[model samples]
Target: MTTSTSSKGSLQLFPFLDLKAQYRTIKPEIDAAIQRVMESQQYILGPEVESLEKEIAAYTQAQFAIGCASGSDALLLALMALEVGPGDEVVTTPFTFVASAGAIARLGARPVFVDIDPITYSLDPGKLETALTPTTKAIIPVHLFGMAVDMDSIMEIANTREIPVIEDAAQAIGAKYNGRAVGGIGLCGCFSFFPSKNLGAAGDGGLLTTNDPEFADNLRVLHNHGGHSKYECEVIGMNSRLDALQAAILRVKLRYLDAWTEGRQKNATRYSELFKSRGLDRILGLPRVQTGCTHIYNQYVIRAPQRDELKAALRGCGVPTEIYYPVPLHLQRGFSYLGYKPGDLREAEAVSREVLALPIFPEMSAGQQDLVVNAIATFYGTRAFAP
Candidate 1:
């Protein structure tokens, strides 16, 4: 992306995501942890992975936790643990990452797409019961963008039907709902430690949390080639174990998660103030947090009528922006077999066109935020500005 120059003839540029900045902040601790893993020579699922699982379980207040290769695998493991297969259906929002529905499809199950709540951009609990069929096996409600879904309504409907809820909490590690962490609220929560997430690792990694001992045990076995010991096989499974190096790095980062979360929250507040002071809120739709849900701001997305034009203008002015998902899952070519048309989910289709994410990281400075907002102001001509 190209950025505009200042009056003093200096180039300004910002990346969509800056991993190196985070790395530099904790280089020593990360280096030592990696060195320790290399020296130990126990590279597979050893002490480091086990230790991280326990630590995460304690942090989320879950009875058990399991580590896996990626967040995609975490969802698959959860479905496998629950024995979801052909003739079964899994319901989820179409506005989420493909991994949420991909996991269900991989298990030979049908993915039922539902429209999201216009306000929260998450699964609408009111539409859930109507979407359920007699073959519905599980419900995967995503805590989209670190905001907890309407879990009370979802649970009330799900519990009555005896349908399991798998929370796709990849972006909401530290978020809470009614004072309870998002991961432990449902039967199982799947998280992603992709380098860009709020609580991320150096490379691809994921974790799952659950309160049921039997489900946790089943997940552990499924992620480890279905074997409890060496040279023994119990059931059909896949190779999706978490690496020791990733576990070590994650442990170092976990210590600062709360602090970083606070930073993000502060930045979100500042953005609101800046937009409101400039009257940009009249043109853009700011995020809304529910009363009982605490948002972690995994992404600070705003809706603008001229989203595409504004994004181009921001790029020209040295501010980079990204679209979380340009298209919903049901309309994807691969899922065309689901027999969905454009009008099936009107809200999701309309939202996919207007949502745009601005730069939001824990290490970002206030000046950088100003630069971003200034660029937007210049584009919309909302307030007088100089290039």
Candidate 2:
């Protein structure tokens, strides 16, 4: 199936993500699942939703899974369950999506920003110590770009300080750290099924996982207007329930997640090999997967000195590339009151400028991969002497 092209005249050879391709592969099953939900006419919490929660919990080895409206809501609900509110501070990285910090600010809690590790592009656990204070109530470690953060160190620090660790597994559903699942290792693991994630739904969906029964119960109430029974309000809450249709769709997609994850890993290996063969290491820093961690390659980002120019060159050659984030969360205009200035987090600031995400989906073809590699090589070869 050919993808519809935009007026930009570029081939549309690569999309940031190819959800359509995945849908085509599982059309029959997905259609059947949707039909089942439609026939049941149970639009809200039902058997499908309950089954999905149980399945996801079993898959992640967690005791419970609470589905929510979106990943941001999942984070917010987790914070609410932990009783994180005004005067509390949540320590987290300054490099992830705005929602990471936004979740904290929503509860009137200050988000203490920490620098990232240049190699991992994850919250630097080593730098976390200095950021802790008397008001620190929780630590949110985001598994940025499908790579797991050093959970052992983060958990150790959290345990020492008696602070809860919330794993922002939005980009890392199946990703593992030291043989443990990303979300299952923390106090509450938050996942996003925003179509672009490793295991995505047709639309916005999220789940919070935990082994603690009380935490799970709290999250359920937190997502459903703080009620146990209909119209019986328990605690102050917000509307964030995951619909049944999305739950059914997710169940079908979940079956294919592991195989898709393997494909992504294989594509990443191919990209690395191609770059190494052309001696591009001198000009680009390839992604590195730490020992014992399984990188799902949600975004095979590379650090290139002239990232923007390289991206433009790729566009000129029918290759698609994207900047994961051009600005760090701490430096964004919305958080100016945090008083973070330039050089506050040197690593995150530097990476924000240099990091570029190439076309990397599970269904990427080898020929497409070759085209992307050749485009980069040609760009570097031509521009090496321009300046």
Candidate 3:
């Protein structure tokens, strides 16, 4: 409930994300969902979890959906189901969250990082061929910042090479590529239901979508300790199950996902319009939506000139901000053994130095967005941008 206030305690500070506001909006439905789950007394993979999987499958237009413990676990489960392990190589972007590549490394597979597209911040499919090798088993293209990657090119390459494509759609659950849902287009799509995700649950949860019946079956078995029948171990797997509480909560949220997405889209559009009107576009690189893709605006990240300075200035204005990632995965200390130098992925590294995310939650008001823009204009010495 604590927000930034003026010296007289009259003004409320806008947060980077207002989960509380979202909660207040849907408190009744959420509370009822939780109470129903409590009354059912089925907290494991019960009716709620089963219903969620079917609903997600229908939403994504995929033939099957498999619920798992977490988004991280979703990636790990996909890799496991695909039988991607030691000596196999998985190609992915170096600019995304660590879990994308960590899933590969965790399974003793090599994460061959490709640079990202400057416009979309997703993997540059042009560089994919160079990263591929005889040992390359799969491709994991992340739909970064809620924008879909160029699936046509990626799918063509994967099909030609006969390698599986696992989409890291943790940020793009409802995003589409050429009129197809993100997770369904790939061989298997992994989505995270982390509290901050577009379709977030109350807690940790994740799911994977696939058209392949065998892959779906394997993912279910893999997530539940690799057993077909109870106490029957068929393959070595980890225990990663989606809790019923999270699933039930997510089911309630799913009904309002489209409405929330529209709100976010409107906010994103308004921010662009505001920035342009204030002449901040010259100094701020706004997010770009691809020709045929729908951007859900999970984070309205912009590339700022002197990002660190702008961030501090915004903080003084009582407007919170976030850096989706200040460091690319290849440059991280733990991945140094991958033999990637600083200049290896120029676009990703360059973006890491300048990308700054402003507050763009679905519940954010136009006045609040104006405040965020005015703060940026003030930082740039534009005096006309008053809230």
Candidate 4:
């Protein structure tokens, strides 16, 4: 509902994510939170970190939450807790941030990728069977673009196979599926506090959520050098612990998260309405929400006709755009060892070429969106729209 006066077709460009705007609104509280951490002089995992973990667990409706150094570390710790090691396979979609699969490979395990659902652009539960094998230890379904995968279908398949599901929910902190928060739906859910995330910290921070107490206990140990007691290491583990400073900052930001999510939701609705009114829906693919799901719109991505060209055109028009993943993970040079050819994962490959992210941050002005849409209209040679 925040509008901007049209610059008569000369739109002023802005950062894709306006973190400063977000910071300004909560400056006093953030400063106090930082001061608290500084005064305590307890920089590592301590009271502040433990308190944040409890808050996150309650927010996600999970039985327990474990904090880690980064989102990548969260995945690594979760896989370690499950004992997924050499020769083991973890199923995930290739159309996501590399950290999703990278964490699997870092543990000397294989990342077995499946195709994505064309409509949802997430791991297609239908094709999951094709990727499962005797070595399959876990299924990692990434909730891409802040939209939850069909949790009902995914859970049914995983439960039948007796395989654990780890949700890659770094982009979906506030998303929900069937009235349950995404991080709580899967066996183990991972979240990131990178500055760009919806619930970002001051820097790198991550959390793991689960209903299983045993898994929670193990994750705690794994995140803390695999020792139930200090200097008595039970197993191999890394030094991945969430620091107190980031935790304190996150505690403050978590309070305003719901309001921010609402702003993003409203922006998404306005974009869709504008696109439909301009008859751009026929040419561009607006986001689709499944029944009983809440998408946080971390990135309001659209499937454009000429995605790369459109992105360039938008840039010329003082609009910024980004391609989430130009290359699917299976085709990446590092993963070529997996021996995947070009068309192996058809839907993922196709989506990689067509998807482009628009600016949908909660603080984005209405005129910024209008300019982006009108610029796209001009690029596609559709009649340009005016506010």
Candidate 5:
């Protein structure tokens, strides 16, 4: 076994993500796609963007996929399509990125806070019912860190209340719940191509997937300034169309999305085995992939007692790590108008202090992984344990 000290000065530092490695591998195909877009000279909503939207829809098994400017815009557009505005309350988890809640608030809708599942780190389905009132119009269950939320339970709840579900699939592109693709299960699934997601573009991009034709048409108009045709404004809509350049790049990357997802799954398995063998299982809680759900492992996050100290030790040993969300959405200053207290969400508050994401990108090597795992083990070994 290679010790962390042996390669202390010689080891290359691992990054939390390795997009450049992926780019280098598919550079030829990517370059050709860009060249095609340039030669066509149709820079805006052209054939490239249209084709990518169709491809994404086909992949997710949705009737339509509307490309947009960013993931936040995708969520905002979904709410607009549903006509969510002031006096409406959208139930969602406080443990995810701020955009999950911010989108609703942008539409003048209130985002009612809900806690998360301790193991899956998704919106707690049980708490959702209590958060619901007559003002509740929808539930936005975010597939946090590439793991699908408990959609079966969420769907049942939504069906009972006659509310729609807008899936925040920004982190989970190929992830599935009960063999159904994430984006297709909900009323509308929102995806992001923010250069770091599982199916990322060269820059910022987003796509909205839906099975309802009318909802799909509404989204198209919402993304294109509330008009079906250019310069034909109907409703008060904003401009959030996807650029042809990013669409071209995304089309190239989509071909290899399945292969990349497989690699992430394999890496996650390796981390499980390595962590278990090192006897860190007792100290750290590994992520759990629910049965019948296929997790793409966008960020192989773990929960540990000394989460901050572990991150510092990993950095010292040339291993990279990240904290997905140090502050829960309800606790964030941006939503202070909601007037939430610290103990309001016990699970979200507890996990916010413990969750740490390890580098689990497709291009990550076993040697690099060993460095991260060994550093974690060393950190635990040196610290005092509680009885």
Candidate 6:
């Protein structure tokens, strides 16, 4: 929602997410791609979408890929392929975007909420086995904030139970776990091309990757009204297809994704150095990357006491910050039918209250980073925001 451009005067203003500056850097390529799609009059899925599907499949090392309307739809299609329905349960963390749980509920299945690991902010594998039952249909592990989930522990637990894993890797396009891409490690990987993601398209787009041809075929049919050929009805499905223009534009941006990701990583390191030098590190809980996980830093979230007050102070100081989710999904009013109550999952509820994301876009300059650090320092005053 923050469409504000990068600041040019005195490094005073910072947008929570600066998509415009990113657009400026690749305007020519983006424009040409869009124009080509327009000239061809191919706005729906066609050669462009097919090409992107191949490129993404190769990028993630998956045997098959299919594009869809949005990340939320990708989750829905994956669930449909597995035939998840009433009397079944899908296990996932309670701290992720609503789409993770929403997809399960939409299919008339129950969503089982599990607590998250405090360090990784992902599903806690130690507690995973306790949530499974005979009717457990699948497990959806989210790669939150561009950090790879502890997939080894999760997969080991899941495989023993004979439960399939659908990875929500929307925030982690290029992130890796133990040298393997996040998408390729699961049964089917779901990715989002929302404008703010690391490898975002010009608009909404999504892709699914899987090694099973049957699963890929099911997903493709489900996304296109349950039939590969028009005017022929197979099974009940939804109307959700990726746009050709979006795929063309994504192809262009995909070329420079690694460089942009490096910029974000370097920026994260600079923030750490600044925080340590200013002793802010003692007061704030910076992100911790696990040994086998390669974090792409889609978001630079930090923990602090009185997070609300700190956010207000940062805004007053001309620094923009965002709370990834001020309220966890289980506690949401819309999901009260799920019968979850306060204190059910302590870590997720606790994290919802303390986490705040700062601007870590590739184009953010060192001066802008300095301004952010200085504002936090000024807010804490002499106590320096002690935890």
* Residue lDDT tens for model 1, 23-139: 999999999999999999887999999999999999888899999999999999999988999999999999999999999999999999989988899989989999999999999
Q: Score every model by TM-score.
A: 0.96, 0.96, 0.97, 0.96, 0.95, 0.95
Worst 10 residues of 1 by lDDT: 1-10
Model 2: pairs clashing at backbone N, Cα or C within 3 Å = none
Instruction: Give the clash count for each candidate.
Output: 0, 0, 1, 0, 0, 0
lDDT of 6 by residue, 1-387 (tens): 122433432222768677788999999999999999999998888999999999999888889999999898999999999999999999999998899899999999999999998878899999999999999999999999998999999999989988999999999998999999988898999999999999998778899999999999999899999998997779998888999999999999999999999999999998988888778888888999899989899999998888999988987777888888889999999889999999999999999999999999999888788878888888776334222
lDDT of each: 0.90, 0.90, 0.90, 0.90, 0.90, 0.90
Candidate 4: minimum summed lDDT over ten consecutive residues — where?
Answer: 1-10
**Candidate 4 local lDDT, 1-387, one digit each (tens):** 322223344343777788888999999999999999899999988899999999999999999999999999999999999999999999999999999999999999999999998888999998898788989999999999899999888888889899999999999997999889988888899999999889998889999999999999999888898898889899888789999999999999999999999999999999999999988999998999999999999999999888988987887777877789999999999999989999999999999999999989899889888988899888878886867
Model 2: CA > 4 A from native: 1-10, 382-387
- Cα lDDT of model 4 overall? 0.90
Query: How much is the lDDT of residue 240 in candidate 6?
Result: 88
Name the better of 2 and 6 by TM-score: 2
Pairs in steric clash, model 5: none
Q: Return the lDDT, model 3, position 186.
A: 79
Deviating ranges (above 4 Å) for candidate 5: 1-12, 382-387
RMSD of 4: 3.3
